[model samples]
Target: MAVTRIAAAAAHFGRDLDHDLGRIGKLISDARAEGAALLVLPDAAIGGYLADLRHPDPEALPPALKPDDPIFEHIGALAGDMVVCVGFCEAEGNDRYNAAVCLTGAGVLGRHRKVHLPAAEGIVYRAGDSFAAFDTPVGRIGMLIDYDKTFPESARTLALDGAQVVACLSAWPASITNAAPKMSQDRQSRLFDLYDCARAAENQIVVVSSNQTGAAGGMRFLGQAKVVGPAGNVLARTWAKAGLAVAELDVAGEIAAARRVLRHLDELRPESYRVSR
Candidate 1:
């Protein structure tokens, strides 16, 4: 039940791998300076997300990296004693997937390819098949990529797999078609926050979320990175800016307290849930 400091970053990343790595290094250093044991960087931190969500140019897509790329070692070296989670476009043969990976100085601890694809996302990346939780230095953790968190079943599957903390790495953007003048008035802004808080509260698991800032082509990202407690209360947030949302908590203790009154996971009636194959 030791208290752990967590940091979620909201920053802009582009197609330049070198520039993105430098920015990521700065974020890792900043989080480490704040005594953060766990840091979650935004989705597409390695390269970047699609320039246009609906009509992404196939030639202008983010550069996909292999799982065993030397840059991962570089990131791990920078992580040192901290547990870091990051996202990137993954290349597997001729196929590519929007993916995330967890690592430390030791190497990769776990990895997840996005399971949910929104609109034209399937046009560029292949969808993953499952959700899984894995052990890390901090604790048992699971990961969700962007649109994956929009569904309750995504987080629920991870929780059922014994995840204590969920790192939701997103490159989520503001409304594409229904754009709003004010960032706060944007529909995606509300839905982003709603999903983060709702998923954490419903699963009673700590959620460390991060998103991209600034615009990539026609898309303007929403950067409401945050750390949400198991009770759904946002412990800290970067709001609509590019920065780190940092918070400290005893992960196991908070989860224990939240579930003590009514254990949501344990009380599930699987027989009653109807689903399509």
Candidate 2:
């Protein structure tokens, strides 16, 4: 089976919920109309993740921002035959979480909260505990949000759980001002290359990443998104533009990539590497 996937950055940040969600909805519709079976939108597609800090109290967040928010029904209705993976803020119980939602034509498949958060975001959102993968019609997909991608152990755990595709939804910012020059572009690009190659080669799984674009507050987004095969090679990539790129994943391509590297997942000796936790 060939899995058709599309990815794009939610480059622009709107002033309010209604404006941002409307743009997100239109982006989804456009991707679906372009014949993408799965669409990956940038992190916090609905509401600006950290751009606006005056977040509603956990209990006061509108239903749409809540995990069980009925707006999922509207998203489900619009899903058509495509599956969607989007980043958002979710409310579960009394705690607010930075989360990514996975929705398919069959309804919501799962929600993965961000386990690792930056110091700046830690004040507003609680960190998550579990790391798991979800099964979709396409295959088993794993999710990691933003900063999580930098940690090898994070994606390694997902690979151990049988994730065929490991993806990240991030609001990546450009370099800060310096007396010499800015290096944020180089930094983010290098990070992307490291995570993409490490996760793909170490686990023999496809890696996809979507990053935010445009400027929010004082930060400027880099806006480069890409799909990489198991061999750590670029299959399809989107430039700085806020557009979508589609790629087809075939069993042959995936298998060849893995076999070409000849993975050693079965030869690990976890017994000797045990840690006291």
Candidate 3:
């Protein structure tokens, strides 16, 4: 079994494209120096997230870039041999999406446009329609953005599609309506960690979670980046601070061990489960 080092980041980023790129480059360099084969960055790491999640100002929306924009070219060049997953506002013709791309210097390995829209997000971005797992140097991987992790089906779909590791990127903020006394105690903070562990354990897959740190616009972000094992054990984490959570594990071996007894994906009774249309 080969051990792969993976890193998840909790860092602050904003709308300035050039500055954001430089920050991302530095994060990549640091992750590479730490021997991380894959680095997962926060959502909206390129152009920043919405100023307010509950009541967004249309004029303050993130700047959108094409999927194959030069900014990604720059990021790809900086990535070199390491696999990096970063979120950005995607511009496809006239429509915009809140999307994340898994890439290496070679090019994009896979891309996920966020499927679940929460609160005011749908006001600015179009929702994605499907979940898929794709191959990378690290292993079979999938991606989900922010609120997407709140839904069980999102990660389950990826696991069914053969994803061994799922990277969840977020610009998740503290409770917008009910602010906590401390960032750590925020409702969103608890939910973020909860969903991370639940998704990893339930799907029997490794979960790499990253989020925006500090404050952007009027929103205060909760930075609890973490790496959760298949047993719902948090191997590494960063709480309410800007940092990188790193872990080294034998991806294939760990998953095999986790599923030696109960294969959650194989024992599902989908027909018995019903959802109202």
Indicate the residue-level lDDT of 64 in model 2: 33
Steric clash pairs (candidate 3):
none
Which residue ranges in model 1 land beyond 4 Å of their true spot? 275-277
Error of 1 at 93 (Å): 0.5
lDDT tens string, model 2, 1-277? 5655555444664447777667777877887777776777777776765653333344433233787677666676777667778887787666778888889656888778999877556767889898899887767888888888888888888888888777778777765432114443366656665776677777777777787888766666767788777777777777666777566777345745576646646666789988889
Clashes of 2: 2
Instruction: Give a tens-digit lDDT track for model 3, residues 190-264.
Output: 999999999999999999999999897678888889999998999999888898999999988999999999999
* Candidate 1: tens digits of C-alpha lDDT, residues 68-148: 999999999999989999999999999999999999999999999999999899999999999999999899999999999
The best candidate in terms of lDDT: 1
Indicate the residue-level lDDT of 200 in model 2: 76
Total backbone collisions for each predicted model: 0, 2, 0
User: What is the model-wide C-alpha lDDT for candidate 3?
Assistant: 0.94
Candidate 2 TM-score, C-alpha based: 0.86
lDDT of 2: 0.72
Could you arrange the candidates by TM-score from highest to lowest? Answer: 1, 3, 2
**What is the lDDT, from 0 to 100, of the residue 107 in candidate 3?**
96
TM-score of each: 0.98, 0.86, 0.98
**Two-way TM-score contest, 2 vs 3, winner:** 3
Ten contiguous residues minimizing lDDT sum, candidate 3: 176-185
